[model samples]
Each structure stands twice: as C-alpha cells, then as structure tokens.
Target: MMKPVTAQDLQTAGFVPERRRGPAVSVAQATVDAIQTMIRTGHLRPGESLPPQRNLARDLSVSRATLREALSILATIGEITAKPSGRGFVCADPGEKPATPSWRFAARYSLREVYQFRHVVESYAAQLAAIGHTDPELAELRECLQTFRRAALAGDISLYAQADFDFHHLIMRICRNKLLVDMHQTFASILLESQRLPTERRGNLMHAVQEHESILEAIAIRDPEGASYYMRKHISMAGSRAGLPLSELP
Candidate 1:
C-alpha cells in the first residue's frame, strides 16, 4: 500500500527549499523544476489536484505569479491540465505517451497574428452580445468585471488574468456564434499570453478595469455600436500596453 503524499513528502522531494531569487522568469522555471521533482518522487500523482496557490506559494516561498507561470509552462507541455471552470489544474499521467503532432503546425501563426484575429472576432462578438444577451448574461458580465477589478486592485496577477479571460470569453459565449467561439478556443494559449503581459503593468490593469466597465455599460444599454467601439478600443489599448503593435481596428 502506498502512503498518501503529504507536505513533508514534498519537502523531502526538494520542493520546499529556499532558493535565491533571480529574474522573474527564471524563478518560474525553478518552480517548475521543483514541481517536476515532486512528480518524479511520487509526491504528486496523476489526476491529483495540487495544493491551493496560496498554500503552494507560501510553501515554496515564491510569489503567486511565479508559481502560476510555472504551472502554465507545465500545462503547455501537457504535464498538467487546467480545469475548465477555473477550479484548478490537475496533474497528468507522466508515463502516458504524447500524441503525434498534427499538420496544423503548418498553419500556425505568431502570437501577434492571433491577437489580430481576436480583435476582429471578439469585437464583433461584443456587438452581438450587446444586441442579443439576456439579463442574466449581462449580470454575469458585470460579475466577471467586478472579479477582475478586485483581483487587479489586490495585485493578484493570476486571478486577474483569469477574470480578464472570463470576461472576454463570456462576451464570445453570449455572442451566439459557434464559429467565433471556436476560433477563440483554438487560440486560447496566445490569448492567455497576451493577457498575462498587461498584469505586469499596474497602469494596464487599472485601465483594463475602466475599459471593461465601459464595454459592459454599452452592452447593458443595448447599444451594439457602442459595444463594438469600446471592445475594439479595449483590445487596442491592451495590445499597445503589452508592447504589441496596434493592428487595424475592426
């Protein structure tokens, strides 16, 4: 019978050592190494949800942003999976073989291209959301905006990014366009990368809060043109803040 892995097990696996901090990105990479050590040593298993971010960050003596970045890297490589509802990430079976790569690589675009595409689809979706969303959908949008604002003000980079993603995702969902939503889903990683950039700059985060408020208000008033306008402006501002070149607005 296997013993259930505890925090002591993680410590034994070298995940609890205090390390000298370097650059932010490097710290994230080190965190990933610590987590990989935990998995290799059976301190974490497939399908096991890791500890809450707060606990893990405290234990590792790293900021939550660094921890989240490490997890994002793991998720990208399929060593873990993010829960669809923002619950948390779960560990993947390390022994499971990865699938063969598809030819979709031939059609892959840069992050900038993906951002351009998002600006087009999401702006149009915002317009549709304004014209078609019900009262409940509008309420959900407001809730997402408030969640984002709170996260931003609290300096919770990971939660703020999640809320920002949820707000745009809600817009696409209520847009009533399956094709648009599918497109957004396909470029989800690029969108996440873009959104993460703004969190590094407080000005960008606060600006996003006001921009989302305006966008939601436009939708609330059932003004499709206003919705489209604000959405476009919001995306443009976000791109600029992230140091991405502004693309032609839709």
Candidate 2:
C-alpha cells in the first residue's frame, strides 16, 4: 500500500517550513508551493476537493489570511477550481490552462481602448516624471520596482498586482502634473484591473519585471525620452499579453 500524504510530507518536500524571521519565501507563497506540489505529485488528485480552509490552514501552519491568499493565486492560475455553495476548491487536471478572467467593465470599455489610452497617458507621465522627479520620489519608485520584482519571482499574483499598480501610480505622482494625476486617480480601479489581467495567464512574469526595470532605469537617469520610450514599449507589450494584438494597439 502507498503511504498517505500528510502535511509532514509537504514539509519534507520543502514546500512548507518552520516560520522564521524574514524567510526568503512569504508564508502565503510557501503555502501556494505546497499545494501545487501536492497536485503535481498526484496526492491531490484532479476533481478532489481540498480540505476545509480552517483545517487546511491549521495543517499548513499558516494563518487563514495567508492560506486564502495562496488559494486565490492558485485559482487565478487555474491550478484549482472553487466549488459552489461553499464546497471548497478542487484540483484541476494537470496541464489545464487557466480561464481568462472576464473584464468587468467590458460593456463600457474595450481592452484595446484602455491600452491605447494608457499608452498615451502613461508614456507621457513617465517622460514628465523623469524630468521632474525629486530624489525621494526616485527612491520610492525604486522601492516599488523592487516590490514588483519580488512579487513576480514569488508568483504571488495579488502582491504583484498591487506592486505593479503602485509603480505606475508613483510615476504618475512624480510627474507633478495635477491634471494628469487627477485623471489617473479617477480611473484607478480600471487601470489596476488592467494590470491584474495579464497575471491570470500562466507565464513567466519576469519579462514584465524586466520591462519595468528598463522604465525605472530611464527615470533614474532623468532621461525623459528614454523613460517615455520604455514606458510605451512596456504598455504595448502588456497589452499584447492581455490578448490585444499589437496591430490593435495605438
């Protein structure tokens, strides 16, 4: 008879470990890795429902919030499907592709329109930020970039989404144009959703992270043209990743 998998088995596989001070992996990410490992190893079979959240969290030695976040990432990437009536999550078949999340504002705006608007506004914002940013603003931008990179590396989609928004919003603020900042803030949720959409598709996020680095380097060096150019490139590439063909982008 095969040995049954336990939390201890996950721990032995290095998916879960004892809590420590500032460990390399976030607790939530560690939990995500643990569950994915279970699915990959056939311990968590396709269509099998996961244990209740409270029980699973207890077994994993992670808080409910951390477990929820991990589960959210898994669902976003289509590793698991959430059942109705509070039934809990079920593992997906191996190699199944994640469904693209529906755009909530599709009735009001198409993705191509959003990307075109972003390309125009954000690229100009990047140029202005490069010219007008103070040292402290630049420092904050660098911090946001680091946060984005870390979140991408960890595969924490929620964190990555926030970091991506923060980086772009910070650049908008640094541009020091009241009208531009007001416009960005007015459509903030829509823009943040746009940032989140690309992450739902299973792929290496490092490419986007590298694009962010290019924008940051240009801003750090106060090269307005370079900043604008990179920002345009990044937004265009992001649009492509979100299923907007390059030809459709402005």
Candidate 3:
C-alpha cells in the first residue's frame, strides 16, 4: 500500500507555516465579498445576472438553502436585487464604496445561520470530491501545491494568499462535482478577504499544506472515505483558525 502522506512530505514540498485566528465570517459575508471582488476584478462586469440558485450553490460549494440565505443577505445590502423567493439575484454596483451600514448589519446578524448551512454543504462536498475526481483534476491539485510552495519560498504574501485560495478551488474540481465547484466558486474571494481583515499572519499555511497533501494521497489511492475525512478536516482547520467550529454551525 502507498504510504500515507506525512507532514514531512508537505514540508519537503516547501509549504509555508501559518497561524489561524479571527471572527468566523458567515457564509453571507463570504458570498457578498465574492460578488464584490468579482466586480473589483471585472470578472462579472456591471449588471451581470448572478447565476441561478442551483448553479450558484454548486459553484460556491454551498447548499441551495444556504445560498438562498446569502442572497437574502445581499439583497438587504442592495448589492443585488432578486424578487421574492426562488428568483435570480442580479448585480448592482455598490458605487465607489463598500456596502453601507444596512448591508453590514445583515451580514453581522446572519452569521450563525450562515455557518450552519455552509458547514453542512461543505461537508457533503468533501465527500463528493473524494469519490469522483479525475486524473487531470488530480494534477490541478499538485499545481496549486507547487504554486503555493513557490510563493511561500519567495515570501510573497500577496501571491501566497491568492494561490492558497485557488488551492481549495482545485479540490472541488478534483472531486469532479459540478455542484460542489459551483458552491465553492461563489465564495472564492471571501475566505481570503477574511484572512486579510485581521491580518492574522499565523504560520498556519504549513498546517494546510500537510492537510492538503493528506487529502491528495487518499484521492490518489481511490479511497473515498479517507479522502472525505481529510477534506472536511481541511475546511475545519481553516474555520477553527478563524475561531469557528469545524462541525455543524450554531
């Protein structure tokens, strides 16, 4: 049998050390940030119709119910307006500034419920990626690893941050689950944004490398249960560092 992935392997791969700390951002916060960043980066441009509910949930690695909550949160802030329940959300410019107090309040108030929905869906996605990832998709995981290592070696915080973010994205792709990938896509930048907020520069990235390597190993060996366990652990570690529980949220 292949040797289980080890911390040494991760270190040898040039993983950066990281410390974890912060107020756990809710799923709504993550979703809102993603929409903001996409506009900031011009990925969605102006007035783009956000993807359908099912599609958004799949891309963001979240549950449909959880994503709906995020949408409600967004609507409160005037970032996107969707009519009634079950309609699509559309992009609206927040102008030159970040969202106003009303929007911020929605995000702050909805924190617990958001996490409750997200953790459940993310746990499920972990299980799916473990089972359905393809070989090319597997290679993407390695590429993310190597890029992160290079960024760490160069002491490039900005680059390391972006790669670290994409690395998680690769995991969803590796799982070959469209729904999961969609869900993850929805919140892509928000996690990074949260990390930036406290500027918590804990040597926490190394722990992540080791954890990711473990997940990859299970996938390489075609062990679904092992893969799922590791994936959930990985998301949990990040959340825990952010001062949130890894299991079901409140």
Candidate 4:
C-alpha cells in the first residue's frame, strides 16, 4: 500500500519553508511553489486529496488564508480541482498523452487563426448535436451550462475556461462521429488558447457566459439550424472581444 504522505514528508524532501518576515504575497507564492514541487516529486499524487486546511497551514508555517490563496492559484491553473463533496481540493487527474505536442502547436498558430478553425469545427458540431444527441447528452449539456454560468458570475476565469471546453466537447461527442472528435482533440491546446483570449480581457467574461447560454438554448430545442447559427455568433463574438478580425470563412 502506498503510505499516505504528510507535511513532514514534504519537509523531508527539501521543500523550503516560507519566511515569516517576507511579504504576504511572496509567502503565498512560496507556498504555491512548495506545493507544486511536492506534486512533481510524487509526494502528492494526482487526484489525491490534500490534507485538511489547518494541518497543511501548520505544516507550511503559514496562516490558513495564505495557504488558501496558494490553493486557489493551483486550482485556477488546472493543477487541482475542488472535490465534489466540498471537503477540500484534489489534484487533477493526469490523463492520456496528447496526440501532438501542445506547446509546439501553440507556437505554430496565432490566436486569430485558431479561432477561425474553432468557428468551423464547433459550428458543425453544434449542428450534428442538434439532430443526433440522446436525452442524456442534452442533460449533460444543461449541467455544464449551469456550471459555466456560476463560474462566470463568480468571475472565475479558470473555472469558466474549463466549463467552456466541456460545453463544446460534449457537442462533439454527441455528434457521434469519431473523426470530428479526434480532430477536435488534436487541436485541444489551440481551443484552450481561444477560450483564454476572450475571457482574459475585462468585461468579456460575462459576454461569453451569455453567448454560451444562447448556444445551449439552441441545442436544447433540437434546432440544427439555430444551433449552428448561434455557435457561429458565439465564436464571432469571442473573436471580436479578443480584438481579432474574423472575416467570414469562404
């Protein structure tokens, strides 16, 4: 059995303790770095629940508030996720290998070109989903819509980004075509970039949430034409908010 690691394990592995006299922000950042090191060193497994807040604060020699700030940052960056039970957070699952190197793809494309591709693929996905999805798939879309709405209202850009992807990916899955799904998966990093671009700018976050809701509403009605039209509108709006010129594709 893998022994459950503790704060002492982290210290034993050379995780540096934050200085009490340091600036609060610096201490918080140091806490984040130490926790990230713990993750890399296998002291903390992906999907493993962290220790209770008080215990972790004591272990790191910082106040619970500072520790919390660090955890929030981790959660935002896809490193960890809040447990469904609400007890605490857990490290995110490390899933299968990507078909391509994400960094290389990001290097190869400008944000402008990426959104153009997204508009083409995602609009088609919404059209197929409107005609082909089962009831359960529709339910899942509704759930993701609610999640995205909550994230937007809270101004959590990270959570919003995740929910945004989930909404689109679900559409692809319901489209029932493996090739479309594969292509979308291959371009995952670029899609993530497009999502980040719109949400990163001020005042665009809520705009995106509203736009997604419109797409979901269209999909829910099983209106293929409406779904495609709304998806195109959503992507176009996102591109505009990101300051990219989206000339209608030929």
| 10 residues in a row with least lDDT, candidate 1 | 97-106
Global lDDT scores for all candidate models: 0.74, 0.81, 0.56, 0.73
Runs off by more than 4 Å, candidate 4? 1-106, 246-250
| Candidate 2 lDDT by residue in tens digits, 1-250 | 2235586767755664547626655676677778887787777888888888888887777889888867866765567877866467888776577565678879989888899999999999999999999999989988998999899889999999999999999999999898989999999999999999888765558768988999999999999999999999788767756655434755
Window of ten residues with lowest summed lDDT in model 2: 16-25
lDDT per residue as tens, model 1, 130-210? 999999999999999999999988988899988999999899999999988887777676677677765553232566898
Among all candidates shown, the one with the greatest lDDT:
2
- lDDT leaderboard ranking: 2, 1, 4, 3
Q: Which 10 consecutive residues of model 3 have the lowest summed lDDT?
A: 96-105
lDDT of 3 at 229: 77
Summarize candidate 3's per-residue lDDT along 211-243 as a digit string, tens digits: 668877877777877876776655544443443
Ranking by TM-score: 2, 4, 1, 3
Poorly placed runs, candidate 2 (over 4 Å) = 1-99
Q: Estimate each model's TM-score.
A: 0.55, 0.61, 0.48, 0.56
Local error of candidate 1 at 179, Å?
Answer: 1.3
Task: Put down candidate 4 lDDT per residue, 185-227, tens digits, no spaces.
Answer: 8878668666766564333256667777788888888898999
Stretches > 4 Å off in candidate 1: 1-108, 202-204, 246-250
